[model samples]
Target: MSLSPSTLSPPPLSLYVHIPWCVRKCPYCDFNSHQGRGELPFAAYVDALLADLDLDLPLVWGRTVQTVFFGGGTPSLMPGELIDRFLQGASSRLRFAPGCEITLETNPGTVEHGSFKAYCDAGINRLSFGVQSFDDGCLQRLGRIHDSSEATAAIKLAQDAGFDNINLDLMYALPGQNLAMAESDLEQAFALQPTHMSHYQLTLEPNTVFAARPPSGLPDEDGSWDIQEHCQAMLADAGYRQYEVSAYARPGRECVHNLNYWKYGDYLGIGAGAHGKITSGHDQSILRRWKLKHPAAYLEAADSERGIGGDELIATERRPFEFMLNALRLVDGFSLTGFEASTGVPRSAIQAQLQEAVQKQWLLVDGDAVRPTALGRRFTNDVVELFLTG
Candidate 1:
């Protein structure tokens, strides 16, 4: 059933700016990134981004941006001068709410002490450092460029640059990784005292070099599970609260930009290979848009609006799967009313599946909200499947 367009609440405003070039592509990384050869045309790319934003303005007008995230392919590689120009142009076109969180993702290897200060001066208050591991051998096995010392220096530099809001990205379950290695990684990460941390279990995703020829000496299921549990315990002991499966943070330090996505908020995605979902109050319609993938092609292209490679107008039936897929990742999950409010669909649509999930002990039916049990989190794909195929 279609809800009345006038009665539906407007979605939150967020911006995701993608930078599609990296110093070098990691062996296990499948993200849309390529090796950078020489000087990058940052000004041209910024112009292209604004051009793309111009086309999306109609969908986001009169909405103040609450968060803006600059995600990979190594946003740290973007020259600080260019970032300042881009942010200035963006803010000039669209208003930013007071205290809006502006985050830039940086590879520890790419950022030095000076770069952190430059980034801060460019108006990026939050820095998410990609420091995958603290062990030298693990870093080598992961094909990461940065050594542990570099990572540590980068964190210290960010702090010195007046950035109190910082996040360290850590990965466990590496090839030949043991409990001691995992715990050490956590210890080193916490030593930085970052406001936020994302401890992810390494998965050999399809199409990556590691997946094609599965890395040797990798941990088995049981060993991986042990490492994961141990590291999570360490993070908890260090005062990091587990908000999502892989994300932990100090109190009030959760990534607001990511929260907008988990809450099914709308955002404008700009740059090569960036994907966006925007809901229109005009037609009560939800639209998904993705830009062209290649950096060279995206730059050479005349217009990015037509350069969009994928577009979809989501059907109401698919909203539950999309909404639940994101919300279920949270430790505290979402309320029944939240699901309805976010999707503008009735609560009854997934009632039978929700009841079955609780009955099967995969979901916790507590006051005001529903959350995945620890067992459910372990077998998350299966839990998601229950709703998908229910």
Candidate 2:
């Protein structure tokens, strides 16, 4: 794979702040989140996060952040004052684009009536609730802290807090989940009238307790397919369009921060266990970086040179696979020119793979745009792998 000087401009820049503490670690969670114990070191963590951002300021100097996402163990668990302070600090340190979308990930069980309003007042325009399932039994099996009713109330509370752009995170194919149960969850979610929803399939990831001790009664492949088909229909009927594989939203309600990611844009990640991608104009090379995973460890070294866990300049040979890994997840796909612009690799490098995909009817390329077919979207991994060198 021969790399050439990129004539394309840099993509949009975003910010991702990770909060790595949760009330309780779920059995199937593989995120860099730890179970909360005793009082949280809220002030210390906030200070460390700001300092970490300071250390990374040079890489993104003068660049306006289009969006800011507070993701993690449960960002809503933090005190409202702390959230306000963090946002204030971030605003002071960086320039935000006009009407920049700021999102906070919260859990229903941790939300307080007054807190939601405070968060909104503090400049959070979007809220994503981690309401994994609506069924109490499924919630228990999944080790979620909130029940169905609390999830419902949380959305109402967010609405009352002046947040019109809200997203509900729901999951299907849980332990003992059938078609009816899946539909029931979707029905409850749709009833809330949320502007956006993230419907995900529950997978037992490696290193999770569920993977170690496999749970019984999980839906089989055929059963999971049935649940997905029916639930998708329900969402479409409710006017929620599927933008990404699992993300659905009403018109103009798609998550801007996530869209930047799927489009292979740039982001600066701060806080514990956060990952970031940046493209340098100096050499036209892309670099990936991450912070330390453990909160205590990250805090201890927040201002030190070793604060970063690791970073690497993406090898020229691997840019194609890396670009496709994210771009191909979009239903509308990407353009050939955009692909070369983002990866800094010529189209000739992957021409063979693109032709092969079209021959197999997995991709539809008409002129400058390249989109995945229905079959391609269904077996996205296979389509993406076509570009992999090894």
Candidate 3:
């Protein structure tokens, strides 16, 4: 049965630009990132990104962008001039919120001392560093190009350059990582004073080198659980509260772009291998579109339809599961009124699943707001699966 789309008031919109080149691809990474061969075509890529944005403008015409994220192999690899040009071009075409939270993902080894100021001048107000681990041995085992010391230095440089809102991405449960080592990594990260921290486990994704040859001494299920619980306590005690499973942040410093995503809001994805979800109130339909995965292919087709990888209209039946996949990740859970407006489906549609979850101690339904219980948060996969249509 093909499901039709429904809608109430449209959700807030955001922009995501993908930069697909990296100095090197980490073994555990499964993102669409290619190793740079020589001087990357930064200028040309920026032009292509603008043209791609021009193509997508009609989809979100007149909408104000609430947040913008530059994600990729390493967005910091792009020179400041190109980033400024891209943002200038984008703003000229679409209205950007006056105080839009703009973020750039940086790899410690790839960025220099003066680049942070340039990024700031280009309108990037926030930074997220890929500081996977502070343990040098763990860094080597993870095949990270940046050492723990370099990560520390790079963060301090950004701090000096006037960026106080920063996030450090750390991975726990690594191949030779113990509880003590994980604690030490967090301690060092605390010293850096990043506004936000994203702590997740090191899962070996398919098609990656790590999955092909799994690392030895990897933590067992019980060991991984121990590490996560300990890290949670450490983060909370340090004044960074866990707002999501892997995300911890001070009050009001939570990542706006990621919040939009987890709340199932709309966003435009520009550049190679970028995927976007947009809800069109005009047609009462939701659209999922993506650009070509290969940078070369995306560039060649930049200003035309050929640049588009594919567009999928989100069917009505799947909206519940789709919404839950993102919405349930939040600690406060989702609101019924907001859910109805975003999904265009009535709360009654998922009432059975909601009751089942509540009965299983996986969810707590208090009037209009629905939040996951601690048990539900731990078994998120199972909780989300209850909404699937069979």
lDDT of 2 by residue, 36-68 (tens): 899999999999999999988888888889999
Per-residue lDDT tens digits for candidate 1, residues 1-390, read: 455445345668899999999988898899999888888888889999988888788878899999999998899998888898999999999999899999999998898777777888889999999999999999998899899998999889889889999999998889888888888888888878899999998889899999898878888989998888888888888899999989999999999999889888888898998899988776777889988899888877626456686899987777778887888888888887777766777777677888888887889977668899988788777777766632
TM-score of each: 0.96, 0.98, 0.98
- In candidate 2, stretches whose alpha carbon ends up further than 4 angstroms from where it belongs are none
Give model 1's clash tally.
0
lDDT score of residue 114 within candidate 3: 77
Residue 310 of model 3, lDDT score: 97
lDDT of 2: 0.91
Give residue 113's lDDT in candidate 2 (0 to 100).
87
lDDT of candidate 3 over 1-390, digit per residue (tens): 333244455799999999999998999999999999988999989989999998898899778999999999889999998899999999999999999999999999999877998999999999999999999899999888999889999999999999999999999999899999999999999998899999999998999999999999999999999999999999999999888879999989999899999999999999999999998888888899999999999988988989999999988888888999999999999999888888888888888999999999999999999999999999999999998896
Return whichever of 1 and 3 wins on TM-score: 3
Instruction: Give the distance in Å from residue 69's predicted Cα in candidate 1 to where it truly belongs.
Output: 0.7
**What TM-score does candidate 2 get on C-alpha atoms?**
0.98
| Rank ordering of all candidates by lDDT, starting from the highest | 3, 2, 1
Q: Give the whole-model CA lDDT for all candidates, comma-separated.
A: 0.86, 0.91, 0.93
Clashing pairs in model 2, backbone N/Cα/C closer than 3 A: none
Q: Comparing 1 and 3 by lDDT, which wins?
A: 3
